[model samples]
Target: MRYDDDPWQVAIWTSTDGTAWELVPDLDSFGRAGLRDIASSDEGLMVAIGYEVLPPEEGSQDPFTQAGKIWRSENGIDWIAVEGIAGQFGDVAYRQGEWVVVGAIDGRAVIHTSADLVNWSTAMLDGLESALGESKAPCPLTGRQRRNGRSLAGWPISAPPSSAPQLAWRSASGAGMHWVGQVDWAE
Candidate 1:
């Protein structure tokens, strides 16, 4: 799994037997970099996506939100930055010979696709709303399933009413959307 250390540096830990883990060293490049999601391409290129929230300047109302970034690694050890793409991007995945990322732009759900992980095109999910009128895809998306030659998609329920979180899953293979299980905090 990939996460940010206490110093806000990206950290990657690997476990083969699901019991013992080994920390990979020197993967941190940016001091204030915090990772949100990561994906590996079919060609062995691994990408980590997240945003760097700058500290609020003097007299500034809010300066927490900053532009997003992408870091690519061929062997998951040494990483290289891919410039020219920036925003509050959440998650990324390599599917169907392309790299697709989903996040919010100006409080709207946006999807970006790239063939070479450099140049990209974006689309806004304007009408993809659930019965509760929660259409925003602000959470990090994950899950890759290729059954009958189609991509499967899934993401968590953003801004749930209760304190506990839930997930909404779907399939590009045309199985429609469904809700997974939920947990109670006071159990």
Candidate 2:
């Protein structure tokens, strides 16, 4: 992960026990990128998702553009950067023989799915419009794979009914996500 103040380096750390950790060396090559989330499959493949900021043209008032970035590793020690899809990826989860990545592009939520991690197919989430309305874009997404093998992706909404956060979940069977639901904090 790259810190806000230090944009030039990205560090990878490994821990066998939760109490002890060691940093992997020579990762300064992943320059000017920030890794947001990382996930590992049952088969031991690991994926990290982030974005690279592209500087605006000289003397232009336009903002910088961002492209999604992905890195894969089998042992969590040596990582290889992979070409990412169009949207800015926030999180990734692997379950039921598929990898699901959640992100946003052009102010719309998008999901990219892949079986082999090298090739991906993108799908814009039209259902997010019904949940978040047409004007608001979902925040950077977060994904989790439950112990039971189900996968969930969600973004917190700051609209009027701020107390109720929205969630989208998929079953362990690798079915399509059900996008409209309130997270019951009481549970």
Candidate 3:
């Protein structure tokens, strides 16, 4: 699922053979007024992130006011919003029997973990505390797990930290890279 442009609407493209693709229409009924990211679980569950904007009260200077939500689908056709998620989530990945979603809340990095995809728990990424006042936009996260029982989460770091993308990985013994900074993607 992605958006190229438009009247700012979302589109779902399906590929049956990995080589050919077709558009799946009538998704406006999904009630996902806006979608940020999506992921699926091996257990046949699909989840998407959506948002509802709330205008700031009078005399407020903040122009970006929004409420984030998570939506779930069984067959990718019908959907319903999951209760309890309170911030924008830009990425999600399922690994090692757990579903992990990362984004930001109140301009701070937040992580959500779930085992069943229905019930979720949230936590703040302590390593990202320095970005609290310096970064306002949600940093999109990409989850990576290696075959050696190592797990990594990468995201573009902002201000007070050199404004470079960093990777943090953990090992089985609970110690690993806290921040491998300034990764060059071109190389």
Candidate 4:
């Protein structure tokens, strides 16, 4: 199991008999902007996300307004840092052949695509919103969304990391929608 409580903290749990449980923390540690979503990739490795954060204290200033960070682990229990990624507090989903992460920037969602889960490509998210046309996708460390919505405002609330078709994330909504998204490897 994973940490569904806080986006910044990651934990691995194991139960051989189905009644006992133990938590494991990985070593692939890195600074987090907000620490949002986590997913297992096709390579059988665990991936953790990081992005822009509100800073430790509200009154304090964050040198970097928002940045992205990525962490990976070979086993579910131990983690390692992936070099060079930016963004904070958003959503992470494994899709097609890459990781689709979404985060907010200046009150709007910024989207980016990554293939190796280490380096990232610029995402303006023009297909989704205009404000993001020329803006870079904000890195999200932790994001959450419901499962459904009846109106446009509810878009992010209904789409989250899904656990169907083996293991993959289907939601493509921009950062604006990442509210409470969590990793669902098993549905």
Candidate 5:
């Protein structure tokens, strides 16, 4: 799982048995920010994605919403940011050795894939099933996403809404990013 902040941050956890869990941190660390989610690639990379909930632009009514950036870490510590993800991004996950992010497309969610967390390409969800909308790929990483419901695709491009899709991805059925079954913000 991950949380939010300035530059963004992520947390990983583990347990011998599902009964007790331990927080995985105090090791390789990324400076704090509003991190939205965490995922791992089979090749051993960690990815975190989110937006900066902060100060407005110096002279405008709002700061140009910073485009979402990708952060990758080897061994879940010591981080690196992937430059050039356009627009405010919502979530991310790593699968196999590929990194996939959930970002808004025309105000709706879309899937993006990156072999390395630094570069990304928005993927076409061909008959891709989402627990929520067609391309609303975000999986709310927090309890807050649990409270909201479904929304229309490509509807929020220019305006803000009370809720947005939570970013999540497919992972191993028993562990990692896939352990949660399915995560959705609007469904």
Candidate 6:
């Protein structure tokens, strides 16, 4: 869960039974950030993704400057913050032995993949530019798992002239994803 204050704090809690919970501490060293999503593998690896808030620039009107942040844990108690990958990460999911994080970089949609959470590769979703139109910024991405061993990523795209956003989706089993079309939620 996340704290309601600035320098947005995040905490992880564990419970052997649903009745009692304990908080994991010392995560403050990860810096000023807010977590967006968390995922765990069957092998007991946990990954959390979010954006790090950078100090505001002098005389700047917008104070929220952000960089992507990732943290990994093996035992759910000890977490190590990862650095270097760039983007505003929105969501993460573990599928087929790989960890996939979805977000936007420079206003463009991007997907990051890693097998060990140490080595990562990035792919830009150029197709989204054509689908979302020229003037629109990249929408936040969310990942969901299906019972059939497939994963899905989706985002809302505005039509034009400020119309209601439509939800577009893509399906993936491993590394490749194919467009699954969009749904008009306004109807």
Best by lDDT: 2
- Model 1 is weakest, by summed lDDT over 10 consecutive residues, at 167-176
Per-model TM values vs. the true structure: 0.67, 0.77, 0.70, 0.49, 0.50, 0.75
How would you encode candidate 5's per-residue C-alpha lDDT over 1-187 as one tens digit per residue?
2222333444567778998999887733444445667667766667777644444456655533344556777766677777766654655555346555655544444556667555667644232243444444343222212223221122232123544433333333312232222335444
Write down the worst ten-residue block by lDDT for model 5.
150-159
How many residue-pair clashes does candidate 1 contain? 1
lDDT, candidate 4, residue 34? Answer: 46
lDDT of 3 by residue, 8-115 (tens): 455677797999998767676554256767778777788887664455566767653557777788877777778866777777776657777777787667667777
Q: What is candidate 1's lDDT per residue for 113-163, written digit by digit as tens?
A: 778877877665443344226444444444434445445443444455654
Per-residue error for 153 in candidate 4, Å, reads 14
Model 3 residue 5 CA deviation (Å) reads 14
Report every candidate's CA lDDT: 0.62, 0.71, 0.64, 0.48, 0.49, 0.69
> Where in model 3 is the C-alpha error above 4 Å?
1-8, 53-65, 129-133, 140-148, 158-164, 169-187
Candidate 4, position 2, lDDT: 19
For model 4, the local distance difference test gives 0.48
- Stretches off by above 4 angstroms in model 4 are 1-10, 14-20, 25-34, 51-68, 126-187
Q: Which of the predicted structures, 5 or 6, would earn the higher lDDT when compared with the native?
A: 6
Superior candidate under TM-score, 1 versus 5: 1
Which scores greater on TM-score, model 1 or model 4?
1
Off by over 4 Å in 6: 1-7, 16-20, 133-139, 158-175, 182-187
The best candidate by TM-score is: 2
Compared with the true structure, what per-residue lDDT tens digits does model 4 show for residues 1-187? 1122245444456678989998765533543334556777787777767643334445544433445566677776556767765445356666447676666454444555678765677543323334224534443223333344311111232234633211112244433323223334234
Which candidate do you rate higher for TM-score, 1 or 2? Answer: 2
Give every collision pair in model 3.
none
